[model samples]
Target: MPHILLVEDDAALAALIVDYLRAKGYQLSHLSRGDEVLPWLRQQRADLLLLDLMLPGLDGFSVCRLVRGISNLPVLMLTARNQHLDQIDGLESGADDYVVKPVEPRVLLARIQALLRRAQPAPLAELTRGQLHLQRSCRRATLGGQPLELTHSEFELLWLLAEHAGQAVSRDTMLQYLRGIEFDGLDRSADVVVSRLRRKLGDHPKSPEKIKTVWCQGYMLLPEVSA
Candidate 1:
């Protein structure tokens, strides 16, 4: 079962969310203040964090930023404000996803599940194919023995592709896997990230051998090329 840490100040809303999520088979830990998050996490392990923007002490953005500095734990921001800027700020601060308040419990649960699925540990300690090596413990990726400088999102994207090497991973699956959000068909965020990751992997946009485009289907990492 995935352990989720919820940092929410609203008592009523928090209770509702906890009840719903617990019923869905997740182990949950709740904290009412943002400042208490890091300290609590240091003492206990949490697979994911559901953070609210408004807090008594530190704000959600600050907490998310601080957590990103120490860990790559996925953060899904819960905000009452529906403003686009708020969502953008949250993502910029290292939040993996954001749920605008008046959100459906089912939607929240689905997001949580997607995030956990992408972050689930593999049977092996590290995964390697040819010159590419990924260290799961440290979330590090190296190509041909050279370290690849990748952001947390980029690393997750690459890891997913590497895991399914030689298979086409659909864009919808990629979006849910990396962002903990559903693809709306119009969202190009996943493509942008893939483009950046391809550049870092030394794959050309016009002729991407490492990460291949499957036309309208999705992207694939060919085992032959990676090996």
Candidate 2:
């Protein structure tokens, strides 16, 4: 069973969520104040987080940002702030997904399921290919045994590519996995991430042999790349 932590000031809503999710076989716990979340997380373990914007202490955005810095815990901001900018801010703060209030219970359940699925990778604790090493639990990666300083998104992209090593991972697939949206053909986020990954991986900037572009397909991480 996946453990879920919820930070919400609304008593009624918190009770509702806890009851509903618990009935669905999830281990649900609620913290009424944002200030208590981080300390609680350090002592306890949870598979995912459900955050609310209106809280007693720190706001949801701040909580999400701080948590992201320390862990790759999937954060889903479930807030009443339905404004367009609020959603953008939540995502930029490192939330895995954002959902507005007045949402159906079934929809909420689906979102939780999706996040848990993404967070739980293969049974392997570490994935290694060629000279690259990735520790899924800690979100750490090393190239030739040297640490590879990576941003959250960059690491995520690398993990996805490494999982599908030797096969082309299309921009649409990457967009959907990373941003929860399909590529618009005009979006260059995937390409930008690739460029950063190549630089960090020391791929030839001019000829790029490690992560190669498959004309019209997408990017492929060669199973064997130089250290």
Candidate 3:
């Protein structure tokens, strides 16, 4: 199910919309304050955001700006303000669409469905090595058939290693690919990331198996299967 994050403070309106959307088959997560949006998104992924114009902690415009800094998730603003200026401001603040409040449930549903259809992600970019699988498009990874929670940096490192499976990928190459910078030899960025990856992948730090160190070149990801 497509997961949506809803940021609305109205108890009655939020409850009514939540029940309706859930019954329509979309997964919904609701929050009351605009300030909570960024933290929630940092820890979890959502397909879309439903924002309210006038929120307690922060207004929808500021919240939308913050979210746009980190993600391109589609945002639909809802509010009692029907002024065209408000709609234009919301759109300029990074919202995909704006709807005035007290809207018919059927129309709201149609707008939501249309937005989701338009925001569908592109083709998946994936790589597999035995029990390890990485979906770069979604930034999701799995190891030993279990989902692995990885940070943005960790996922990028893992994707680079998997892309060049069975061969040593130079630290310089990885650094450039990930951060758009050359490895400084003094930089421990790759080392720190590799350590974190090892722990998450259950590889022994002292005697690692999945990701192994090269004497001088860099690191290598042992191919789990010959296919």
Which candidate wins on lDDT?
2
Error of 3 at 87 (Å): 0.5
Quote each prediction's TM-score.
0.55, 0.54, 0.55
Model 1 Cα RMSD, Å?
14.6
- Candidate 2's clash total is 0
- Least accurate 10 contiguous residues by lDDT in model 2: 78-87
Model 3: weakest 10-residue lDDT segment is 218-227
**Tens-digit lDDT track for model 2 on 46-156?**
999999987888999899988998899999998664588888889999999977897578989999999999987767677898999999889999999899999999999
RMSD of each: 14.6, 14.8, 15.0
Clashing pairs in 2: none
What is the C-alpha lDDT profile of model 3 across 29-120, one tens digit per residue? 99999889999999999998999988999999999999999998999999675588888889999999977888678988888998999998
Residue 163, candidate 1: alpha-carbon lDDT = 85
Instruction: Give the per-residue lDDT digits (tens) of candidate 1, residues 38-129.
Output: 89988999999999998989999999999999999989999775588889999999999988898799889889888888887757667787
What's the lDDT for candidate 3? Answer: 0.89
